[model samples]
Target: MIWALGIFAGAMVVPAVAAHASVEDSEVLAAYVQARAADASGALGQSARLHGAALALDPNNKILAARTLRQAIAAGDRPLAVQAARILDKAGELAPDGRMLVMAEALRRKQWKEAGLQIDGIEEDEVFSFLTPLLRGWLAFGARKGDPLAFLNQASTNALADAYAAEHRPLLLLARGKKEGVAELAKAASDDRAHSQRLRIAGAAILADEGDRKAALTLLEGDLPPIAIAREQLVAGKKLKGAIDTAQAGVAQLLVRLAVDLNAQNAGQLALSFARVATFLAPENSETWLVTSELLAAQDQHEAGLAAIANITADDPFASTAADTKLKLLIAAGRQEEALSQAEAAVAQPDADADDWARLGDLHVRMERPEDGAEAYGEAIARADSAVPGSTPKWALWLMRGSALIEADHWPEAKTALQTAYKLGPQEAQVLNYLGYSQLERRENMEEAERLIREASRLQPNDAAITDSLGWAYYLRGNLIDAIKTLEKAVQGQPADVTINEHLGDAYYSAGRRIDARYAWNAALVYADEEAAVRLRAKIEKGLKPELVSP
Candidate 1:
């Protein structure tokens, strides 16, 4: 069954349907497309239903068939996937779909031999080259059909063109109980700096097995991300990296994964470490440095984060991006002047592209340098307008300029920029809240402001600033009780956040919970600076302390 996703109001994109069709059928098809396109990762069942519908309608379409098979594989529906692949194989073009379908089914059923047999028939053709064989090597090792390390080493060398396969080979060998093979395979795959960490890890694992605990401990503590197979590698033999090249290739591979998924919280620390390793391995990989900086900034490690981001010189592939990130981080870190100056330097560089100018202007706005930021933003806007379609980076500049104008108290100009930001990224919670808060603070467009703030709150339920805004919005409408409850929840989630505590205290006082309010106020004072704490003490003294409620 093809899966579908629930519609998202923030995701304004209409699902693209198959070219043209009858009006009635088109609407139904569009709904299916829209459901499939919705960002519901767990709605695989729904997405599968849509794909199935499309496949049934266009049974002759190879791409549609392949898509269905892939979806089935992802959903772990082996019977459905096998059905699709068998049909494709009958169609005479076996483009890896059937191969993976068989393997996936075999893996699901734990049929190790049949799984190995699926990829075995195509062993000679380098053109049939894929990662399936390397995966099979793992299955074979587990089955004890051959020497695990030797099998993986030979298969991997033949399939080394794919970077992912290359990295997995050494680990697979470790899994198969071959310690010395690790060092040999590591040497072959060491040309890519992004992969060096895996090689080093494999080497260390081999040594630990030989009872060289101290040597293994040193290698295990090395900068590489921990791999599950390291334990097995040590069980095999003695690890050695005395001749390992620290500057080997493939060290940056981990950083690349993080860059592809910057919002992945679990990968944040590992990404930062990989970025550092990449920076150490290949100082020339400026893009890796920028990715590192971006990850740090996203994690709110601003000071050192900005330092990582700002290091990208103009010669790098993502120089403008790095410089732009640096400006944002500086602003986020509250080092506004430094952000402004950094922007200035970026725009001034001789090789600085038009993007550099726009990015610089946006930085100015973030730093509260309105005139300069506005001017720079305008240059970027003009460049974006003049560029080829899909090439103009207009929307972000427009939004930044608007934010800058808001800071400058230029109401009309700010509104225009805010609207532009909406057009570019309609679902952005921060932009929605910011615009809504501005309108509320100015005491105009009250209804629209409330709606926008509510929407923002829905999108970011746990965000401290958004939660505070929702509570305040409620307060504005005389919903004092709701304000108190909402603000208190926000405070609880972020106990260390001064903003949340202050807002909660204010809401409590407004709702006539004077004693409860006093306790919150006192707590805030305890975490405040000496001068700030002194002033807070007055509020704590004036308010009554409420009695504890029994559960």
Candidate 2:
């Protein structure tokens, strides 16, 4: 059951302090400035190091210590967090988050009582109130002290948290070999639709473990989503595993859930540390590995992300998604050959699905193999059609096929597929943008193209790409005034976009603003693609070609 809870923890901002008469520490101030500069430059590790040095030089400054701790967390420096935590704790200034880190450390060490004590020190807040009992319940179950259901049942005050507890308690019960809570779990599974899929999957696991395969299959057949379908397939095919059974795994699940909360708050590196701890506790859990890899990638640690994704074994239900993620990371790291090889391998697998073929097509396109890309996209469409038979294939799949065909210069087939996609998803901005832009480039269906481009602009008013298309459509229709106004907006919204700036330059020249046109072309050269750069340089040297100049 996906008990999706959104509890955002706002980051604490440290206020900067000027050097006081009594605290005239030049070294500390200099280190602080260096740390700030490092943070602004995206050098998080350097920031963390400099902040630590500053904190060491001014240990008594609570604000500096707290800032250092935050930087350390962002850099994934556990030892540094511990060092900062000690200073905060000694001064009785540790906040709820600082306490949670200490609690996680205690949980890691299997010091149950110490973990409980740390939980007790958490400042009473909305999340704390919900989390406290849940933590205590998990501890009780782990420690064999009291009924987990009693503490879990107390979570009814909040609907979402209650749903989480309801979904969580059963997996723990089955893991511990207790059947007394089966009835309650079944009821909880039917309680809320938001989390029902995960609950049903959990229920199926429990039932299957108890040798009730028929009942388990029944649960799996009801209103199953895609992820649940994966679980159902694994369960029916006898490839699924039993529920999480260890105290460590239980704690890891808690930490993973907490990591999700932190991710929602955009605390990527801090969330990575929590996810890493979860993986350390339950190395076989594919979910934590996926999250850890994504967090690593978000922090620009591509190699580390690949390492985490590598841990997803073929037997895991998440393996395909993990493979796809790994391939993208490889491409991002400039290992296009490696990524293409991986994509080729995936499509060659006996059971590769339409999605796998689609991914392969994308990889080929990225590698600049347009013919191969067109062939792969065709195979994907064929597979999808064979799987679903005659229903309007996903608009996105058709859209992708259209794009590939366009790159291959097969205009008739490309136009057919794009029209099909546009018919299916008439209101989709991207579909409107691509089809309209393509028509503009081909200099056909000028009136229809203008309507489609204008509709796209209305749907996505802030989208610079869509605005660029609208401006281009106006330029093609000889509406120089409207073209100039719209292109200016597009350039303002995306000043660094080479194509948008080029269009703006064209609009300016057509409107007799030759000086502004030259300035825009010069700016476009800064970020232009090779072809665009050539065109921009020609325009700057001799102005727009005669036919393209103002009448």
Candidate 3:
């Protein structure tokens, strides 16, 4: 079932229509089939158009109308979305989301009463009821009927809903020109969540507007690109603009937050619908465009994602994020060369920072140019070190450089980098596993490697790769029985991993299970890379040599 329908699973069941020989019925069926295929393939825009065509032929079909509404919202086709939404609304078959679409259109036109009616039409859906109070608050604020903050502050048992309400409470206060909002905003921005970061940015802008320069600067304390840009602007005595200046923008912020949460839950279509509505509410808001782009990319609509990202201007605080998303979309669309070119250009700028160099390194690594990746990572480490005098770069930077060096066969440097990473992040399981596995593979520091791998296994016992490393460690120690048992467990955890399968085969052969060893090797051959496939075939044919046996 589509994730959008998962929230109300089994609530609405469309009765199957009787087969008809009419040409109109045939055309509708063909279009519906084509729409389903397009949706499955992630061609959401095409799917929306096809669904619309099918619905046009069978205008009274509630199922077709609902499908068209969902597809239209996901594809950002506002006209079709409105048409389908109204159809369902008039028939009293509108889902919560359809009501939201109708409300969004009313909100767009400042038809507060119409929008309120649509909001009132929303039934108590488990997944959507949490938004009801917020919708009421924003609607009241827009219509000047009551205190918006009162509606937002109404107690709720839903923790997720409360968090969102808390986030919006300060913004609503600020929009009303209340000075008490500064303290509340400060409290909300203490968390590290993305929404909190946005609050921090908005709060800082509000402070700057109020001439509290010191407080504004203090709010923008992070090293993120957006914070850095905002800090620079504040330092230059420029007024930073607040995120939500109007009631429409407030609702847009709410929808964007909802969209992000839904997308994280793997409901891309539902998320896109909310994001599209947010774009209509706050068309110039860079954050809305960024969220829209990310959700579109999640659906494999890379070209459309790029188009959405292009809405962000270069001077926008989210420009860096937009650039990053554009790079991902380009790569996902098989335009690696363009992505590389953009990455290179970004790093070539005189003011390019560690992030730019790191992004270039990442792109190089993705393109299988590990040598270039190592070089770029080296530059990133250098710039990062310079960025904060006397402080070491982040452990992840060293780990990345180490991995790139290993891929490029620069083992000596890789070992040094990996050791540095381990020193900096001894508690990180990934760092422990990588460093230990590298030492094990090189036949160097065998006892130490085993110790590291053992600690990593303790840290993350369910991690298949680390478990496989522990098994391989036992095999190298000539503990054939334990090795076979551990390797078999590892195979069960990750049956398709070529290295783990090969290790199991090796352990089996050493345990005198010759037929079982051959079987394991044959299984490994099925999923092995070309190089590993040749080695596995040879192992299956002749088995392990006596001298090569661990025991």
Candidate 4:
């Protein structure tokens, strides 16, 4: 189950200190300025390097040391992080993250006592309090002193902490090679509320290693692409490597889980910090790298993100996920051509699945090649049909293909696809809305279109696009008063939506409110694409055409 945690506040802003006019001060200031700029641009490695340089010039600067420690950890520069952590610790300004870096180093050196002290020193805030017990447990396991399970099982009021405990207990047990680990893992995997894919994969790997191949296969029984890949590997007699086979790897897994949870909550920086630490601890774990790459991409560090995922080879279980992430990163970087090329290459592979073809279709649509998109989606549909014979048809794929066909002006083909989608998923609001709106635009089956739109509106009352479709249907039926009212509500829901605003403009002009019509048209023009802008400008200049309105 997904658990919500309170977001940690960002790093404390360093108050600027007035520096005496000197050559050294000027050099330090220049480096500091460059560091801030690099940080802003997501050049985290360069930022850390620059910050370290500035700190070297002014070693007594506590704020600079803190910033350096943070950026160093963020950049996955362990040596730099350790240096900055030492500086911060000496000055008694070490934050929890700095302490974490030091603790991580302690763990690496097998200094269990030092790691425990560092964990103890961490102020029990929302973020660390949740982790403190887990860290203690891992440290105990590594030291072979205390009962790690007891530390993990310590009851907590926080449900999220308890959930984490349930996940980690089994992992720690497995790491110790205990037979009970398999049963505990199976039990944990069966608890849907506390279930994790990591647990299942780990359990499956352990079971396979212990010759319980059937149980391993059962553990990974799912249609998800990752599960499928694992199952195929198992069938081929390949031993699936478990994520956590040691105390250090267990700690890394814990950090990776926290990183994922924090990223889900939109805490990108904090997530990156955790992910980087995990990477440092378990560089062999491709999952940590994947999380690191995704978090980097989210922060607009596309190049770094790509570089991070490059570590995952073609045979890695995470390769597919990495490829998908790479496509997104390329698109976000405005390298759509590169993304399109990758998508093409992916679908050209002999074993390419429906997902690969669908990705190509999506890329084509993004490039405005609607006809190509429709063709690619058709291939995806064929593959999907072959993959699951006589199963329920994939309504979503048909809907996408239909939308692309409509964009390409293949009306008959579009209608057939949309009808197929409606047949498969009549209750799906998106399918209903797309089919209804496409028919409305063509002025075909007007009565049926109205019925479909009304049902779609009922299913998704807050959806501005569906609401606009309903409003447009009213206008087409010559109910100008109701049209204006409904269209106004649609505009309120999405004021900047070009289609909604333009629809409102049309309704206003049809109702003889010329001034309101012009205002709405102008608003739409502000946000419209080139083609829509030209049309909106014409409507603003001469009002709606007489023949376009219902009599």
Per-residue accuracy of model 3 over 1-551 as CA lDDT, tens digit each: 46334223322322231032124566766667767767766677898998898778777777788889988887788999899988888888887777777888898889999988777776354458777788888888889999887887762667877888887888777767776777788787786565666677887776677677877777788665577777877787776754675668888888999899888898887888899988888876778888898888777788778878898887666666777788888999999999999899988999887778878888889889998998998898888865522122467788999999999999999999999999988988888999998988888898999899999999999988899899999889888888888888888988988888888889888888888888888888888888777677767777786443321
Residue 106 in model 3: shift from native, Å? 2.2
lDDT by residue (tens digit), candidate 4, 1-551: 11111011112232252142223666767667767767776677898898888788777777777788888877778888898889879888787766777888888888888888888886453447767878888988889998998888773666777878877887787666666676677677673322265567777786787787877777677655566677778888987865576667778888888888888898888889888888888887778888898888877888778878887776655566777777887888889988998899988999877778878888888789999999998998888866522122478789989989988989999999999999989999998999998888878898899899999999999999999999999988888898888899899899998888888899999889999999999998898888888788888887798543321
What TM-score, over all chains together, does every model reach? 0.45, 0.59, 0.73, 0.73
Candidate with more favorable, higher lDDT: 1 or 3: 3
- Number of the predicted model whose lDDT against the real structure is largest: 3
Model 3 misplaced regions, further than 4 Å:
1-42, 50-61, 123-126, 239-242, 348-353, 382-396, 419-551
Question: What is the per-residue lDDT of model 1 for residues 1-551, given as tens digits with 9 covering 90 to 100?
Answer: 22223444212333333433334546545544654563144344455566666666655556556666655544334455566676676686545435544544554455767767655643432333544445555565546576543544555455333445555555555444545545546554554243344455545544554555555544443222122224333444424322222212222332344333433556564444445544543455455566666665665566656656655654332344465576787788888877667667765776555566777766665555787777777777766654422222466667777877877878898898888877776687877888888787776888888888889989888887788778777766778888888877777777776555655676677678787777777777667776656556656665523321100
The weakest ten consecutive residues by lDDT in model 2 span 1-10
lDDT score, candidate 1, position 382 = 68
- What are the clashing pairs of model 2? 1-198, 1-199
Runs of candidate 4 with Cα error greater than 4 angstroms are 1-23, 40-42, 123-127, 176-195, 348-353, 382-397, 409-411, 421-551
**Which ten-residue region of model 1 has the weakest summed lDDT?**
241-250
User: Which of 1 and 4 is ahead in TM-score?
Assistant: 4
lDDT string for model 2 (1-551, tens) is 11111001111232343333125566667667677766665566788898898887777777787888877765556778778877888899886667777776776677889878876876253445566667777777777888766877777887766756865787667656666446556676664242344445555666666776666665555422323544556555664542455566666666777777788898766687678767766777666777877887787767667877898886554555677788888987778888988788888998766777878888887777766887887787778755422122467777888998888888899999899889988998899999999998888999999999899899899999999999989998999998988989998899998888888888888788999999999888998778778788889888899544321
